[model samples]
Target: MVKSVPAWLRILSVVFVALTALILLAPLIVVVGVSVSESQFIAFPPNGLSLRWYSQVLSSNAYLGAGWISIQIALMVTGFATLIGGAAAIAIHRRQLPFSDVLATVFLSPLVLPTIIYAIGMLMFWSSAFGPVSPVTLALSHTIIALPYVVRTTLAVLAESNPYLEEAARTMGANRLQRLWFVVVPQCIPGLAAGAFFAFNISFDEAVLSLFLRGPTLTTLPVQIYGQLEFSPDPSVAAVSTIMIALTIVLIFVIDRMLGLTKFASA
Candidate 1:
């Protein structure tokens, strides 16, 4: 039988957990509070509760334009990263190719490198080859960074999967494509879904790469917020941040409803 914890220890654990959650959530709470402030200037605990900033954000052309650009790029990056990374994960997991370990490391190397470093390198390369920064360039950069998360998540799910399932399918006269479509793909759905979520979130929220590549016509939502923060500090920035936080929470809720989050968490 497992030993029970002392009452004091349990109470201490509860306090520690509560404190940790507060620390983690404090910034989000502040941003949400600032977004609803009646005062023109940003402040914590809010001068008077109002949603004028959110209304201002909705009316602003710059914010709407930037948000549209972000959505487009994020969708493109999510599609590319999910398809390429899922395929890469499957290949690596099967160990069908030579130097599989090296390949896996190379795929994950982007996660190890600093975002700034990648941003600089991408800027130079894209400028020389394409002659200008565009939405496609930004989407490609986002895909590179987002790829590792997809690969990692897919690999995690594959790790816990039965090694003989594919073989078993083949033994029953299923062809290569049939086994992959009917057997392998089903097992990878959870991981691919989780990875797609991460890819979308990362690409949508990524500021460093967007900053490096942003032109007047190509500014994304994060870069727009940064520009406002640098020049005209206002509660509108906080309002946008609060909106992003809410969207993220909604996305998480949707994902949880579709596939139990515990499966991804366990993986």
Candidate 2:
């Protein structure tokens, strides 16, 4: 039988949890605080609560253009990452390939590699091979980085699934496509959904690759925010950050309600 925790240990755990939450949430609190401040410049412990900065962000053409570009690239990255990573994970899990382990390692290598290193290397390579960086380049680069998350999450779900499901389907005379579509794909839905959200979030918030690949007309929202911070600081930056945080939270909430991310996470 599991023993109950002592009072002292429980109190200590509560305190530790509170401290960890504070540490993790402090920056977001400051950003939200600054976002609503009436002050022209960014300041936490806001002078007065206002939504003028948000209005400014909405009205600004530069912000809108950057936001649109970010959305487009993020969507493209999510689609590519989900499709390719999900298929790769399934193949790796089946061990049908000659070098399944090596293939898995190759697919996941980007996760361990330094983003700055990859960004620089990719930028140089693209410049030489393709001449000019485009939104397509950014989408592909983001897909490469985001692919590992999809592969990892999908693999986790598949690992927990019944190994005999495919064989059972085959015994029932289910064709290859029928087995995959009716059995395997259904099992992978939760993991694929979670990974898709992760991919979208990463691509939308990605700054390193965007910074390296940005052209005159191809700035993403993160790159624009960086430029603003470097040249001129304002509460508008905080407003943009708060909006991004809100959108991400909403997206996660929606997905969790639909697919129950707890299943993917538990796996």
Q: Please give, for residues 98-142, the per-residue lDDT of candidate 2 as tens digits.
A: 999999999999999999999999999999998999999999999
lDDT of 1: 0.93
Q: Point out where model 2 deviates above 4 Å.
A: 1-10, 258-267
Distance from true location, Cα of 214 in model 1, Å: 0.9
lDDT, candidate 1, 117-215, per-residue tens: 999999999899889999989999999999999999999989989989999999999998999899998999888998999999999999999999999
Candidate 1: which stretches are off by over 4 Å? Answer: 1-12, 258-267
In candidate 1 the C-alpha lDDT for residue 166 amounts to 94
How does each model score on TM-score? Answer: 0.92, 0.92
Residue 113's C-alpha lDDT in candidate 2?
A: 93
- Report the Cα lDDT for residue 192, model 1: 94
What's the CA error at residue 182 for candidate 1, in Å? 1.9
